[model samples]
Target chain A: MPAPLSRRHLLARGTTAGFFIVAGQWLWLTPREAEARVFDPQVLSPEQCKALSILGDALVPGAADAGIAAYIDLQLQAGDESLLIGKYLGVDTPAQTEFYRAAADNVISLAGDKNSMQTFATNMASDSLSGWAGPPASYVLFVLRADALDVTYGTPEGFERLGIPYMAQIKPDKPW
Target chain B: MVSKNCDVIIVGAGAAGLTLAARLAEGGKSVSILEAGPERKLGDLVSSQIWARKLKWSEPAVSESGNHKIGHAFNAGTGTGGSALHHYGVWLRMHEGDFSLSSDHGVGLDWPLNYEELAPYYDQVQAEIGLSGDSVKERWRPQGAPYPMPPLPLFAQSRVLAKGFAKTGRHTSPLPLAINSEPYQGRPACHYDGWCDSGCSIGALGNPLAVWLPRALAAGALLEHNARVSRVIRDANNTQRVESVEYLQDGERKTMQADRIIVAAFAVQSVRILLSSATEQHSAPGNHSDKLGRYLMTHPAGTIFGLFDEETYPHQGVTAGQLLSHDDYDEKDAAGGFGSSQWMIGHAIKPHDLLGYGTNRPDIFGAELEPWLKRASRHLGNMTVVCEDIPLPENRITLSDRLDRDGIAHAHAHHDLEPSAAARCTQRMSEGADILRAAGASEVWAGPRIGQHHMGGAVMGSNPEESVTDAFGRVHDTDNLYVAGPALFPSSGAVNPTFTITALASRQADHILSIN
Candidate 1:
């Protein structure tokens, strides 16, 4: 059997064009450049939304462009009416807002070094980040990545990007 | 006794309640169903997984405590059809041994009626709902009527995963599904787009909306939505006879008198209703023996995932998976295990959500995430292992001290898997990985063993001292009160409980009709 694709090679190919290469260091382009700027979030504070966008984009490329922050903010504002997958995974509907706010605050504190988003995410995944508090960093990372995936690759156009057929019985109007 | 407004009042508009309502109404009885959730129409059944969350249980959450907490929010549904609206159409019958758990192995409670008594009802329900499968190929399946429609065609994903069973010297058969493979009756055929979890809008899957609600409406069964039933009220003169049902509709406490009542609001809620009926005058009905909320059971289930070299195109078939292997279903004494188990193979998975390929793997993210997910979306092959849970009295559902906004006590489920049942789950998961590897999977991984089909709590038995209900699902303490759903199950069989729930409800309806 052929060897598994190496991480280094995958990253090398990933940084070619879509990524922002600044000062010989590759960084994910901020979501602000891709999405609309004049947006009013209902639930998340400005800082919390920014942190979510940055962390979400770092975890899943193009998630910001897919409106990850807006999606999460909309869901959080919906309270019990939220369509988030976290509702099914033991996170109560009322606590969903606090869960995201706390995680986003933690992300802002940890991701201070803008040079390496991947390294920051790796530390979050392993829970090796110093002074980490609240719901485990790994869990937050998992939920964020899942939310990002929902906005990015869970739609018909997103399926196109992954080369999978979107044989939806009734197509969704938007990713929501 | 209070004046009666209806002959029968069903607490929930779910699979069991709706089925019973249709049957009872058709038999010239006035039936009224009180549903807690908002009314759901076929057009409301959107195909988006994100939008599909609307179909799930939205009532005040059921507090859970257990080694394997039942995914109640995900598993239980709300609205007109209840949980069956989002069910994946995996219709399966319990093996004969499943009926007599204590009689056969001295573990768990035994059913009041044996498999022979329920077999005819099962056949009748299968025919009524229109199941699809090859009965002959299902060697382990109990004797029953053949499926009305042919089995759903295996998509590329199931075909690729079937190779794993073949390579491992295991047998597989077309999964018996309540979905229509071809146009049957007035319902259209399943387009095989894998959207059954989002509620089959095309009326192909035999959800309550497609199978029972139409018949119920046509039969003039009064249906009320957003009506949260509080408790069944007993007659002031005689506590043995239920008089009426008190419920909250439009934020007003209302009482609807009925000659008979059936609580079919799934397991925990059904038990909660009974437990909440505790008044100053009398203890909750069926609590005389303190067995009303005991033996709460849920199947120990988890998915085993693999990435095959072949382009499996894992997003093709139904969400319930395309094939089933019940080879060890009746082997309660298998080595290193104490219960039955089965594998549902080749689920049509998605990129997001709790069970999605992207979410399960938390370790893989950032640059490596997209590539891995893209590959997994195409090459992934996954199967779910469902193992029987031993019914332990300690694994119970009780009324919690905590109250919801409506001031009603919440239901709390406390479950701990028996060691033997846990052992069975572990053994099956190990075998699942091996099967995937044998099928030429380069990598194989398994998800955490979690709870599936919730049952028991108010289980049925011949002895009133040991169980809450009788053979016909009539509560032992009351003459007109019945429990018609998986909540009446005495054992947690390693199969989806909807088919059996429908069957039991059918039998209960027959009994009720015959008496009147």
Candidate 2:
């Protein structure tokens, strides 16, 4: 649930040092690294990306490792071709970037180092986050969780991890 | 301009458009279809849930509002096959009482045609599409030809949930589905993989890709992909007849002329197309009565989920669910509510996505997430309750003031659930939770009441003053323009609308053919 290995450092260093530290494991080249090795975010800021990764990981443990933030950033850059679950939830494509930013900003203001990540997540679920702005905290939590689930267990590999059959009539050549 | 003439020009390549196109083309008529989205084939339906997001409505977003919002993006789809490509294939007929809503309950508008008039077409469509179910087991089912295929095998979740219906003195029947149980009509049978929402790539489910698209293509129907229809064009000399259509294709505005035109772009989009057809000489076709976008309706529905001690294997069957109970479907005057409702029991569920087990429970996460998901993956029991939405003229679709980048006005859908229908949905959801508890569930919970299907707007009626179209789906104001989808429905029946949409299209095709 901790923040990603600062994008500032990834830029300061070269592509060789661009490694994601997930679940105490040092992966040489994760999917996130492979997809966006030199990350230049279009819609999301570094702080917003960090906040989304933390929030998503808190909701779904392996989501950070699943590159939820990268997946989201990629979709945001996709514009009308966004594959985000929020697209299906009635958040218009043009407004999706603002929606995610505002929600992430709300999370940042609420979780001012005083509360644990678990406490923040629980407050989010209960809609008890004081002075919360933007969309309802519960709704934001739902969207983030859904996004996390998308990356964590929405793929054939993820289904196999849970012992469910990955029966495919036409299998996806690549995970989004 | 890529100008061409055809016998018929159908707007939108969704279920209704494809069905009508296939039928008319089979009768030796040259058919042309304009689809707002990309071309989709059965081979494009990948099995991964993440990749499945591409199958949903990816066109310009439809603005929605009101207490129970019509879930346009979730319910509607884009591309060649349209929404039917990603549908779960739950095909149920509207009950006889569903035809006359105002006459029976004094609530919504009554359909121009009764179930008996539509029943023969429904039978013909069902037989053609190959529905699988046991008619005798469906005690409350209306009279029709028995399903062409035996019912799909029920999984453990359905078996467990059936006990709840039995314990509550209710009868359970195998869910009628458009999915093939065995290899039929050269299409492969379902593998019970539970990916219906992701689009059935194997041609097992009777999606447009497997059913109508091939027929339409084989019968020489020309489908124009990525061609977003702007408006229907009326002839200058004869204002009463629609002569052509204006549309955008490959970044160029083009016009296509035809002897006949049918707008089958689903409910909201269909209404948008008609409303955008407004000209100075005449208002939008079907707007003479000021009832073009009136009487919008969407079913108020929810799901009930539970954790059972026994191994349920919830993901072993179809996504449309495995069983149905219409024992109380026809009861409109129940104490708690005033609309018909039905229960689709035991869906083959996943751990993610909107209706999946994981997303439903945002409370269980962090360190305690994987175990819960794993357990639910193996032992979850779930069923959905679909309550009828009574049509209200105030709940309508209108052209939004804001326009898309392409200068086409976006469609705004406003729908407020009727108090009676809301009450009925709440009651059914509560009963569903109780049923889960009675079915030996260790824990049970109810999901939020969300909009299920979109229907009505540009409704059909006997009186031209009250409705946009006549019984034949032809607009009263225009001779050549017709609507052939759920948008033509006068009443929002509790059952799924795909079967009825196809049946209505069949009827419309017959009418068109008989005209000349």
Candidate 1 lDDT by residue in tens digits, B1-516: 357799999999999999999999999999999999999998877778888998987658888898878778888888999999999989999999998889889888788888888899999998988999999999998988888999999988888888889988899999999999999889999988888888999999999999899999999999999899889888988889989889998889999988899999999999999999989998898988999899998899989999988998988888999999999999898899799999999898888877888888877877898899889988999999999999998989998898888899989889899999999999999999999888888999998788887899999999999999998889998999999888999997899999999999998888999995
Name the regions of candidate 1 deviating beyond 4 angstroms.
Answer: A1-35
Tens-digit lDDT track of model 2 for B1-516? 324499999998888999999999999999999999998888788887777888788667888889999999988888988888888999999999999989988888989999999999999999999999999999998999999999999889999999998998989999999999998899888999998988998899999989998899999999989999999998887899888999998899999999999999999999999999998879999999899988888889999999999999998999999999999988888899889999999999889888899999988888899999899998899999999999998999999998987899999999999888899899999999989989999999988899987899999999999999999999999889999899999998899999999999999999999988
Q: What share of the true interface contacts does candidate 1 keep?
A: 0.70
Looking at candidate 2 chain B, the ten consecutive residues that score lowest on lDDT are B1-10
How much DockQ does model 1 earn? 0.50
Candidate 1 displacement at residue B218 in angstroms:
0.5
Count of clashing residue pairs in every prediction: 0, 0
Error in Å for residue B385 of model 2: 0.4
True contacts kept of 2: 0.84
DockQ of each candidate's interface versus the true one?
0.50, 0.66
Which candidate gets the maximum lDDT versus the true structure? 2
